[model samples]
Target: MLELRPGCECCDRDLPPDSADARICTFECTFCVDCVDNVLRGVCPNCGGNFAPRPIRPASKLTNNPPSQKRTFNPDCFPASR
Candidate 1:
């Protein structure tokens, strides 16, 4: 199951499970559309992998399969150590 993350890892902006703005890498490193396009250049800063729009969990299934509350924010500035 996909871990529907609650926010963008880069900007820490809220990205609820149904948000259309969420983007993620193969490693599930989440970011907002703004960060993914402008800041990240459509690649994940953490994994150096391409990003794609995150899948939205359906509202009916959300009760049983809730989105993750465990927010994974980016604590470091950009140009993180390679």
Candidate 2:
């Protein structure tokens, strides 16, 4: 299940679950559209991989499947040390 992160890690922009502006890398590193395209240049600053629009979790299931309580959003952690 997707954690449906609340905002961009770089700019701290609100990214509601249904937001079309949300982008995610393969490792689920979430960022805003502006950050993904302009600032990051389509390369995850942390992951070094391509990004895609994040999947929106249905609101109806909020009760059954709550969004993550994890408030941390550190893009620095997405890429594994090589």
Candidate 3:
């Protein structure tokens, strides 16, 4: 089951479960679309791989398999400016 995180790890942006701007790596490391594209340059800071938009989990399944509400914010993972 995908653990739907609540916020962007980089900029601390709010990323609700249904947020279109939410991007995640294979490891489910979540980030905002802007942070992923502009700041991280599409490179996942934790996974070192490309990111894709997070799939929205259906509400029906949410009751049975609840998404994670835990926030795993990583503030020091931004790309270094040249």
Highest TM-score, which number? 1
TM-score of each: 0.89, 0.80, 0.88
The Cα error of candidate 3 at residue 31, in Å, is 0.4
State, as a TM-score between 0 and 1, how close model 1 is to the true structure.
0.89
Lowest lDDT 10-residue stretch of candidate 1 = 73-82
Worst 10 residues of 3 by lDDT: 73-82
Q: How many residue pairs clash in each candidate?
A: 0, 0, 0
lDDT of 2: 0.79
User: With candidate 3 superimposed using the best TM-score fit, by how many Å does residue 37's alpha carbon deviate from the native?
Assistant: 0.6
* Candidate achieving higher TM-score, 1 or 3: 1
The predicted structure with the larger TM-score, 1 or 2, is: 1
Give the per-residue lDDT of model 3 (tens digit) for 1-82.
7899889999889987778999999999999999998889999988799999999877787788777888888778865562
lDDT of 2 by residue, 1-82 (tens): 8887788887777887779999988887889998887777789877689999997777898889876655546655333441
